[model samples]
Target: MKRLASVVALAVVVLFGTMAARALRIATPAATTGTAIAIPAIDTAAAALHLAAAVRFPTVSLASGGPIDTAAFLGLHQYLQAAFPRVHAALTREVVAGLSLVYTWKGSDSTLAPVVLMGHVDVVPIPEPNLRDWEHAPFSGDTAGGYVWGRGAIDDKSTVIAVLEAVEGLLRAGHTPKRTIYLTFGHDEEVGGRYGARVSSTSSWREGSSRHSSSTKGGSWGHA
Candidate 1:
């Protein structure tokens, strides 16, 4: 009788374990459906050229906290003004912290919060030892081999140029948004965003308004 009782207990345990495993295996996943947004088209060749021009500037942020390339940064700013004439003319451009660039495109409605688009123009310095490893000069802004080769090509300049191109195109088309748009190009993001992005955020917050949303150049957007 004791042997029979032991056999029954083992059978019950097996049955419950199998039932639990089967239940877990058949469980449904959470829903992930969402709406899709349609982004407007931009000028590919012109945007590429602008990005290439941006890359030529060696706005390198030294890790050891050395002097920044102020001349190159000013040159890049001049280039941006030349490339996006409509944006510079239409938007309210301001140089925050003497290095960062901020452009505000005033919208039709003042009640709505402004949207901020951010990107870094600063890039890591290329060491002399790794210079030979590069197929082309790191600061050449070479658009050869069907790719933009430079230090800030992908790290940030591409994004800043893309945003400028989009805004410039919109300005050309005379499209005005309901909410204001803010373009922030930080100059010292490689070391830390302290002097550039931090100052902008603090200043804006002091004005009793914050960003509604933020879109970074690396294709990330989030609500504030």
Candidate 2:
């Protein structure tokens, strides 16, 4: 009887596995035009070019609140608007410090607390030996060698680009997450929030946030 019961259990497990494989095979791209109208993302080649152009916009912040690279910051902002036209056209974009950009995606339930994902756009001043230490120009967003090289290439800008890309891709695929995703890009986090005196300011941040899932990090992004 025991042997017979074990065989029955194994057979049931195999049946479930077969059903799962069949289900996966059945999942196909739905025939629809909903995604096609919402998002037309920039091509991968153009995306790489946008990253390169973004990295070239020198946005190193200062502590004394003196003159800043306003032109550079503004240019990057404009680049974002141009790069993710789907996002710019659909999501409401709010700019702070001429660089800090916040994009909010309303969720199915607006009553639930919003999830904020934080990143910084500004990079630290290039060290004196920065150019010598770098294989490519520090400010140059070189897309050569399968890499986007720059001071902030792998850092916050990547996060910014990623979130925008995800939204663009989702809107294109007509998919939406259950909860809201808030993107906060700080402009002066590299300078201890003292960039540009008191005229413009960067807010203080922590490694984690309580606004989102306890298991999931708020995604405090920092990379070389």
Top TM-score hit: 1
| lDDT tens digits, residue span 1-224, model 2 | 99999999999999999999999889676664422345546477766777778788897876655667778888888888887787777666777555577676666765555566666678778878556988888897888788899978876677667667777777767666455666667778766644322212333221223365211123544321
Model 1 lDDT per residue over 1-224, tens place? 99999999999999999999999899685865534434567879778888888999999876545777799999999999999999999988888777888888887888867787888899998888999999889999999878898898998988898889888877777788777888888888888777886655544432225675555547588756
Q: Provide the clashing-pair count of each candidate structure.
A: 0, 2
Q: How many backbone clashes does candidate 1 have?
A: 0
Error of 1 at 105 (Å): 0.5
* Model 2, C-alpha of 127: deviation from truth (Å): 3.4
- Candidate 2 structure, TM-score to reference: 0.66
Compared with the true structure, model 1 gives a TM-score of 0.78
Looking at model 2, which ten-residue stretch has the lowest summed lDDT?
198-207
Off by over 4 Å in 1: 1-41, 63-65, 201-210, 215-217
